[model samples]
Target: MTVSVAHGTARLSAVAGATAGDAYVRAREALTAAGLSEDDIVQVVEYVTDPAAGCGEARPAGVTVSTVAVEGLPEPGATVAVEVTAYRGGGERIATGSGVVTVADEIVYVPGILPADLSAGFREQYRSCLEVAGELLKAAGLGLDALVQTTDYTATATRAEYPHCGRPRRELLGGTGADGRPVHPGAAGILVDRPLTEGAMVSLDAIASRRPLRTVNPGWRRYETLTYKPGIAAGNTLFMSGFGALEPATQRAIFDGDLLAQAEYTYAAIAAVLREARLAGNAVVRLVEYVTPAGIADYDKVAEIRAKYFGGPVALTSVVCSALLRPEFLIEVVPTAVFP
Candidate 1:
């Protein structure tokens, strides 16, 4: 296990083994390395290649934990990646915590699948999950309209099923509502090899707030891309769009067949957008990397770039996927930053 911390965020990467016990032990050592204890942890994001490998049962009762099963991991044989957010001091209890839901002020964190019969098909399961999310938001005095960011982990062979997954989100979250007008949250869909559940087709993870959000698109000309904001800034946090190694002006992929160069270019692009939003690399709190198998082969190069770009600790998760939005694209990076 390798642990790093910066500005209260801790990232733990382990490949020693894939069991839940190994993840727990690594997380414990990471907290100690960050000079933090279990009580300081606010959120935990776990990535596993096999959902059946369950996260160890050694976690504290009230912390927010979100786990997802991905296709592969950056570490050659590693199947689990754990990222944690801990405060400088004893973190305040901003909101009540339940099994997989945590509420704090304007933020809500929910992970894994919503309680629903997996016997249904993908569309039915997705709608049921969103229905549950809507009800939870209403209970918290929020609604689907308050969503700022979302991640859809779907068990599919390709991106063809992406539209089917987005239908529910569009109906539930995109459009005019009682809230006066509607806003679409920044979203990213990753094709997972499998879900935590045996027959489940899709799993949803989200972060919502009561505050309004503003979208940021730097150096935008006109190009065909998915329907999502480049960056959504709400309160002190900036939710960035997934960036690939593409030229800023031409919007064409750069460094074909070169994973390291593409990765460096992608990071540089993300940094440029951060600067446009008046933030810096150190402000980043969380980062998710979607990579193909070839990219994973040279994972060390990516880690070296990450270590050089951010001087402090940042929670990180690297997932191996079948493919990104495009076949030529080897890596896609999603980053979120909290400002001072």
Candidate 2:
């Protein structure tokens, strides 16, 4: 087990099979070990067996649902999983990029996100996230053009299944300009996955700055914005929104039903986003990963991925739980890129 803490965030990488209740207690313990408090911890991420499935009558005790996605992983059974990431201090210093987007000015969550009924998934989930991102930009008086980076999440999107999901995403955020003009492409990163749910294909989180778009990338293969966020904040510091393990082209999950593959795609996407943002792999200074119980056994693999890409000494946290959008998505990644 390795733990690192910095910038008001705590990262714990451990290999232990624990139930939901146990993972909750361990989260508190990890916080205490880092000299942090529960109140200071804004979110709780965990990887535990599905309380409703594997545990069944033997479900752990005292696990209150602050946030939960019960069916967000591989088949519910004895699966070893690795997880990493977190947002500390209620994510105060790290302002919501969506909060600053001028165009996406509101946060609306449609409870019944039916993948089959994409209107709800797109309008309420996909479009709503962009709306929030746009709102964040709008609050800062910057149009959607000011945005340089973005990350998306979905619970159960596959290549065959994502086209239907991407339809609304493309229409709403595909190429619309800040002034309501049509652009060639839109958004920075689109990550989706498969979890246990019906028609819950999208749940996105993003990070951007009120700063100006200064850096530009010559490599124009990317369909979306070359920059991840607008402006260079206090030097080239890149704060990323939460991302997951979906194949970029189809917008479907790459891992199928594997946490390891999920983590790999996630790290790969982070690396791609960093490079696209003109930052190095090591620029990943902070990470917050969401995991499910099915992935708890392979905790080492998550650490390995971080160590491989981010190197040693970056702050990370692994939370055991479900994704808001899909049930089979075992991992979702949130990263911060900082340059020297």
Candidate 3:
């Protein structure tokens, strides 16, 4: 499948906001400080406490947007946190003007899509989400059968039900291998204690491309039966799956209770993927850190750890959440590396 292209990444959570407009202004200010303007933005990711409360506002011109209602933002009292992926250089880009973006001869990024029936059951909500992605891509002359990556945001109350949602995902993202196995995307799932829209159980942000993909596993066989790859390489870009400090062999969390230790293991794993993909740490353009409440106090120290792994500047974001897929997973990371 395909995924989003990233030349650069930036975090907007550093800006404190009392309102959506205030957050937007503060975000613009922060971008200016970083030497990036709105014209460079390719995508916008916003996290809010309530979607039905109108917490999300307009984003930069010609950018794809993904707004999810989560537990909280990085800044206290901030109603929303925004993150952006900017176009730094080197790619044939196309914004379909309908939330679908593509890198010609590479991959396609389908904008944020959720089920139309917010009150539906988990299965229905999930199927509809993928269906929406399929429809949107269809309008842009693409197909969802090539979906290579996805980020699912589900209501925390339905935690146990997410695994089952995979059933619908497989049914819709249909590309069975010759071995009779399902072709799964490199997926990342997060749980939210509070949803922006009342009764909205799930929402999704996905990417797909008809281009060929090479799996970058770093010898992690545990992903063979999973719905995602450790990393997927499309042309010169690598889309890495969300990873914590878990040991793939035993399925046990490593360096438990220590945020820095966990982050180290996580970054090492990421490094392994880069090495296998023939990329260097410097190739990474974005990092999205999902930190649980337990790790927030220690989150500031993570930048130093990140520096040890990535050789250059990165668009980084650290978002605090009530909990992760597992309580022991104090932090999880998803990164995109672009080859220069």
lDDT of each: 0.68, 0.45, 0.72
Q: Can you write out model 1's per-residue Cα lDDT over 1-340, one digit (the tens) per residue? A: 4454543444454322366566667777778876778877766777777878677575566677778777776555676766666665534343332344555445666545453768887777888777777765665677776777777777546356556756776677743323343346777767667767777777777777656676655756432243456677777677877788877677688788889898888888788878878887887777788888767778767778987776577657677886776567888888887777
Cα deviation at 259, candidate 3, in Å, is 1.5
Clashes of each: 2, 51, 5
Highest TM-score against the true fold, candidate: 3
Q: How far out, in Å, is residue 235 in model 2?
A: 6.7
In angstroms, give how far residue 10 of model 1 lies from its true place: 5.9
Ranking by lDDT: 3, 1, 2
User: How does model 2 fare in lDDT?
Assistant: 0.45
Stretches of candidate 3 above 4 Å error?
1-16, 30-40, 55-58, 88-107, 174-183
C-alpha-based local distance difference test score of model 3: 0.72
Greater lDDT among 1 and 3 belongs to 3
Worst 10 residues of 3 by lDDT: 1-10
Selected candidate, larger TM-score, 1 vs 3: 3
> Candidate 2 at residue 29, lDDT?
64
Alpha-carbon deviation at 95 in model 1, angstroms: 10
Model 2: residue 127 alpha-carbon error in angstroms: 2.5
For candidate 1, the 10 contiguous residues with the lowest summed lDDT are: 174-183
Which RMSD values do the candidates have, in order? 4.0, 8.7, 4.4
